[model samples]
Target: MSMADLVRAGAPELPEGYFYRVRSTNIRSLKVEIREQRRFRSRLVADTWVFERPDESAEESIVKACDRAFKGWQEADAVRASYLAVTAYLGDHDPKGGR
Candidate 1:
């Protein structure tokens, strides 16, 4: 199975208006999506972490990664900042917008 599928299966339950947007080609990469919100300030939980574990299913690895992201975002200020940066970068990339 593709890593993307694993991520999709392993994704967490985000707060209302929040979601994780996975890259089409890069399965390991993803960013947070906050919908229809004028403002938000909490640190976004996302980072490039090696999720694979020995003897574990792809789904399990991804679930562990998501867990770490969630935990770090909740417990660390730096994680939140990193999350914002990722979201900002993603927000800047609008395929529908005329370039």
Candidate 2:
């Protein structure tokens, strides 16, 4: 699937003012930035995914960058979900996973 399609399917409800763009990509690096809550206090978070792209065209670079960004977002979401689950399991408990 395309990067856009993957992001849309995964993050159906994006924060207000959330936006993503390919920042730069070359034979050595791919970079993308995701901006969220840009109304008054905007936050810009960038993630870079690198891979060898020798002989790749600009269009190919862009597509790869977008894909990397999408993957990074997905990985971040998974980590967050796991953390929440652990937190919930811990709750107001002691060392044990209980209240």
Q: Best candidate, TM-score-wise? A: 2
Which segments of model 2 are wrong by more than 4 Å? 1-16, 24-30, 49-54, 91-99
lDDT of 1 by residue, 1-99 (tens): 433454577755556644444332366544332222236544344543544567997566556666666666556667667888888655465678857
Q: What lDDT tens digits, residue by residue, belong to model 2 across residues 1-99?
A: 443553554423344566655544555555566657655775765465544467885555555665566567778889999998888765355667545
Write down the lDDT of every candidate, Cα atoms only.
0.53, 0.58
How far does residue 43 in candidate 1 sit from its true spot (Å)? 9.4
Ten contiguous residues minimizing lDDT sum, candidate 2: 6-15
Candidate 1: RMSD to truth: 14.7
